[model samples]
Target: MRRYTARLLGFLAVSAIAAFIGAGAYVYYGGYDTSALQQHSEPVYRVLQYVRERSILARSDFDTPDLTSLDWQHAGLMNYETYCRQCHGAPGRAPDSFSLGMKPAPTAIAELARKRSPQELYEVIEQGIKMTGMPAWAYRLNQAEMWQLVALVKQIANMTHADYDNYLVQAQEESPQQTETRPRRSEEIASATELPTMEGLSRIDAGRVAMQQYNCTSCHMIPGVTAARNQVGPPLGGITQRSYIAGLLEYSDNNLIKWIRFPTTVDKDTLMPDLGVSQVHAEAMLAYLKSVE
Candidate 1:
């Protein structure tokens, strides 16, 4: 009887090893096609579907924090245009061709958003999943911006194309102008020259306040400025440190200003708007942004 029991245990162990070997072989031998153009197999598709549902359900249990006065819709619109629209697309628009090639292709969040709670959305934005094109945003954005994105995702489900365009217009209108010639008071210029020592509050903090006041954080993911973990536009964490403005333009104050003022001319497909930023305010904001390490 003891011999029979030992043999049974050995059989079980051998069976487990065989199963592991077979699964590994199938994966390593390229038995499955991984092209995005091809539909996922039943098992793979079911796993992804389960992950999507379960992750949302598990993360949704947390209490959503208060953001009573924040106008996230405006912030989201700008973010969407700057970062998300190319991949996720807006109402009546389709995602770009390259986005379609992504293995799990970026979904139009506007349609899928109704099913997720705010916290779930936030988790996805902040943590990001492995082996997916999605990037983890915790390192690049602050908590407030992440929450703003959650709010925007929730609101996007019912928005129309016109509504999105109108919000974009509002964001553009809020951008500071570049041509105003206000005389700097002597004291202000002297203080500026002295480079008032910054403490406790970082440039990021000041930028955050400026973002909120100007509604810049309402749209794009301004790293260190807002708390949203959105990928709506390229992260703005090290904009000042970049050696180039866009991928093509050489980085310079003039180039940055020109890009900000005339994004369309720089790149016809560029989504950035002429925000009408005045020269002085733009310079101040740029200085603050560049100061960020």
Candidate 2:
């Protein structure tokens, strides 16, 4: 009886080893497909999806702030329009043609935001998912801005079609002029051509134009500018009066341009996003800021 049991154990161990070797050999010969365009088979998809979902659930630790305080819907909408809308799409808009070519196509994330937790949303935004075109903004946007983006996405999730359309229009129209307080005299009001009829704008005029165009006052309160008042970001009313930019960067012309164009490089958690400001725009904005101070 003992001899029979030993023989049976030996047969099982040999079979297991043979199975392991066969599987290794199959893998070594390139039996698996590795194409970005190919949709993962059911088994692969299920496993990957499970891992992604679980990892986000387990790793996400960001706190969801009071979205109302930021009134951040407009602040977020600008960047979303400039950056995310092309890939994730708006509530009523369709994604671009190239987004479809991806193996697992990007969804209209404004709708997807409804199904996700804020922490998970932040994780995805701050650190983009691998094997997809969704770029991370950890370097481009600060923590507060990231949360604001999340907040706007949450609103987008629950909006009706008309509400979305109106909201989008309103958000896009959130210009500095809306916050105008005292009446402006004809000469006091800055016009598109008030500075000079020259080819290039002076530094101060350039800065003023860029700030107004980008709606810098949406998050801050510049002394002379008409802008929505919010405590989310500080006022640059007398930026030159201060010694630093965003309380960290040195107060210099070169530094100001660098911050304007690539703030993420300056402060990883800055509320500012790289709106892809050109060298000319950055210089103009800097000139305006310096002149005002």
Candidate 3:
């Protein structure tokens, strides 16, 4: 009986190896088509979509905030226009020609906004689907701003075509070419806390303010913020003590600066988005982070 069991196990192991080798050969030899225009068959597309949706649902544990009543629709509208309108048509617009050619074309987001809850939709925004053109903006935006974007989506989903067009005009008027564009007087765009200069304040104090504004606390356990019990990112209590950043780069000012200013450049698949942080801001934040040790 023991000898029979060993023979069966060896047979299964060999079969597994053979299957792996066959798959590798097929891929390496171009048995799979890699054309963008070659759309996946219905079954393949459905399966991929199911996996993406489930993955988003599994990770979206955040409580949906009070977004319905908030005057965030305007900010959300701008965000939609800037980040999404090109790929997913707005209420009165059509998606661009290039976006329509892609396989599994971007969904009409107004319909999507109506179908999914705010939390579910935010999951898609915060952690973009893999292998899809959709990229995560968590690194670029704060939690408050994200909520406003969501609010705008919900509002647009219910708006008449004329209302949406009117909205675009309004948003355009408010958007100064050089300065930041945000929703009407929401906390997200309220002038940065009237804090002292980075040099006048302790680095920790300055870093804390930057972190708060950037919504770092949403993903990381910042030392002093009350709402920083985050689990998505590594806690930053001993960030400076570590010898590496993201376990890939050597720990140094230049590396840290790059990581902060352009996290996606450091790692292509990183969830961190570019915030367009200035060199001076990153340097100051690094000083505070290093001091936290």
Candidate 4:
């Protein structure tokens, strides 16, 4: 028995050494493909797939909201055309050529939405994901605009090509020029200035005021929140209509509460600030936001 134990230990040690040496060789000799154009190996693909699935499962917890009566359909459509269509594609459109080269390429939201809850969808749009190409829009967008985008994503699964095109036209009409567009910095700064003084305002009005007070429009593209000239963040015409918040967090009242009161508490490294919002203000903000649809 003693001899057998010794032999087993020796074998384990040898295996460990051999595995490390092989991995070291692979790294040093550049054995793994580095080209972005190349498709991922089966193992790599499986790992990434698992990561995405697990991420969604763990982060998305809110109940799905009813999108039938949500009135931001046009806003959602416009935002999608300006911000999302290039990577996710529309009913008859293909993703841009550059998007194809991305590892774990951006999935068609139209297809992915079928498997997700609205809250989860909202999280992805608002917070985005780390180590992926997705960027956080919390600093850029206010709560209302975020929700509008959420509403639009909910309808992507059933959108027809003609419907998408019409939306594109509407978005163009909402904001005619592309290159010079972005939210204005001055508006955001002004919004922040008056945020402390506003009282008893509805969430929508509060959000609009907050956005303008903080100059949120300067960095983000919210249709009614700011002018058509500024679009640092993706367009947010119909965010309230979206199902997800940050492409991860489900759009729930509680989650939105947490997000507004303590953004970094949920994700420590998030770029969004706490913004010094009081609980009263947070509650009012959420109440106004929930009224979007």
Best by TM-score: 3
Q: What is the per-residue lDDT of model 2 for residues 1-293, given as tens digits with 9 covering 90 to 100?
A: 99999999999999999999999998899876677667889997888778878987886875678777775567676666656777787777776777767766786776567788888888888766776666655434556667888887888877766876776678767744433223222222222332221135556665665576555777877765776686678777687667888888888878877887788988898888766665655667766776767
lDDT for each candidate structure = 0.64, 0.69, 0.72, 0.65
Indicate whether candidate 1 or candidate 2 has the larger lDDT.
2
Q: Write the number of the candidate with greater lDDT, choosing between 1 and 3.
A: 3
**What tens digits encode model 4's per-residue C-alpha lDDT throughout 124-154?**
8766776567755554455555567777777
Task: Give lDDT tens digits, candidate 3, residues 56-103.
Answer: 788777678888766564666677766777888888799888898876
Q: Alpha-carbon error at 109 in model 1, in Å?
A: 1.4
* TM-score of every model versus the real structure: 0.55, 0.53, 0.62, 0.58
lDDT of 1: 0.64
> What is the alpha-carbon lDDT of model 3 when measured against the actual structure?
0.72
Q: How well is each residue in 99-153 modelled by candidate 1, as lDDT tens digits?
A: 8788777768786578767777877776666556776544334466667777777
Clash totals, every prediction = 26, 9, 1, 58
| Alpha-carbon deviation at 107 in model 3, angstroms | 1.6
Report lDDT (Cα) of residue 19, candidate 1: 99
* Cα lDDT for residue 262, candidate 4: 74
Candidate 2, residue 147: CA error in Å? Answer: 1.0
Q: Looking at model 3, which ten-residue stretch has the lowest summed lDDT? A: 182-191
